[model samples]
Target chain A: MIFAVMVALLVTMVLALVRAFMGPGLYNRILAINTFGTKTVLFVAVAGFLFGRPEFLDIGILYALVNFVATVAVLRLTHLQDPWSGTEGGEAG
Target chain B: MSLLDHDPTGVASAQNRRRKSTVRLLRTAPLPAVFWLLLSGRYEPLTLALGTLSVAAVCWLTWRAGLAHQSLRLAFVLRLPRYFLWLSGQVLVSAYGVARKVWSPRLVLRPVVESTPAADLPELSQVVYANSITLTPGTLSLDVDEDAIKVHSLEQAGVEELRQGRMLSRARRTEARG
Candidate 1:
């Protein structure tokens, strides 16, 4: 049963990765990446249970914290770039 | 505490700064210590002491790393349980909704970027709101500035919900209670 959950999370993560690669906009890519991160946490926790080691939840929490920091960092960088400005230095491109 | 006596060596100010950091360190220590205890699954005194020492050291380092040292307000801390319960409920509901939509034949995604005024809320509450949006399924907080937050929604429903400002009011109430 736990293995089934892990499999579903992995499938969701793959779908999110596909969306990240096919982004119509930068925010779309960021959103996909964030979703992937969340799925990764769930995947790790479920996989831990499937493998008979619940201690992996601690690592899952660590991944969650890292994911949040990464999201904040990416958001700050994107905001600073302001791709809509169209100026060379200001553009995300 | 003689403020009138100005020492040329500036020892008093240094002492004051150290004391402030110490207080911040203490305020933040217990949380990480409890986390460590739970993760380590140990009741041994040596392990507990080591955890305490490490948590204190890390807290002190972060405190000195120039992060704003807002001492945790007791009122805000007390409200965390309620806020988190509400947030988790929202996350679960949206996660289910998004999952169903993703599996449906119709890929009806209507993503949009909308800005909401953030200046009216306290700094911590602003952060809480942003994180809550990001944690939910259909909404992502793309940018947060002094005046507003830019959020991207996966569909019109999420967009309308945010526009209605129920979550914003809930966040404000949390901060207000604190």
Candidate 2:
């Protein structure tokens, strides 16, 4: 079952990868990459279970933090370059 | 203090959210989990130590890299449970749609984008909405606006149905009330 879940997440990752490649705008690419990161977390967790290593949950947790940090980085980068143009205080938190 | 119930009330204070997150993060990170794995007899000698070390290394590197940080509003953090429930149902429904298309005789994909809105909601909620949409099998949040979202769906009708869905409007309301 865990293997099956990993495969499904892989499929999702592939789709997101496709979107990332075919993006119409930078936001589209970032959205796809974000999706990829999330599914990767789920994939890691399930794969860990399948391999009889529940300890691998740490990887999943780490990936979760990485995902959030990546988004914040992108958000900050966008602010630096004024790409998203979606917030206040110019560099508002 | 007991681990389960020690000063539970004190933890609820908004000021503690940061401290709570920091501790919770350290506890749950892969290093500790891998440690648990070894302590509980899951990993062999070399594998156990290596696993924990690698997890720790990544955690340390990522933290120090200091990619960037924009602290989101507390309101968004508080609403995570509700968002998780909303996302589970959305992902399931979208998965079914994707599977049906995969197994069906003729592909009926009619993907389209519909303008929707996350008006009057905390920006964090909007970010969650955008992120969650990408997980659903047949839909992606292509563009978002304070007043609207451009949802790309596998079918135009899916986009239509999404506009009428409870999750979007309720999410909007929740953020608005924040």
* Cα DockQ of the candidate 2 complex: 0.10
Q: lDDT tens digits, residues A1-93, model 1?
A: 776787788888999999999998998999899999999898888888888898899899999999989998888787886433432321112
Per-prediction TM-score, please?
Answer: 0.71, 0.52
Which 10 consecutive residues of model 2 chain B have the lowest summed lDDT?
B1-10
Instruction: Candidate 2: list runs displaced more than 4 Å.
Output: A1-43, A63-93, B1-79, B176-178
- Residue-level lDDT of model 2, residues B99-159, one tens digit each, is 9899999877777878766665565557766777777788888888766778888888666
Residue lDDT tens for model 1, B1-178: 1112233557888687667656666777777777887788888999878887888777866666433244457787788899899889999999999999889997987788988666667767887889888889999999887678898988778878877888888888887852
What's the DockQ for every one of the candidates? 0.12, 0.10
Worst 10 residues of 1 chain A by lDDT: A84-93
Candidates' RMSD to native: 7.2, 9.9
Instruction: Chain A TM-score per model, please list them.
Output: 0.82, 0.82
Q: List the residue pairs that clash in candidate 1.
A: none
Residue B156, model 2, lDDT:
80
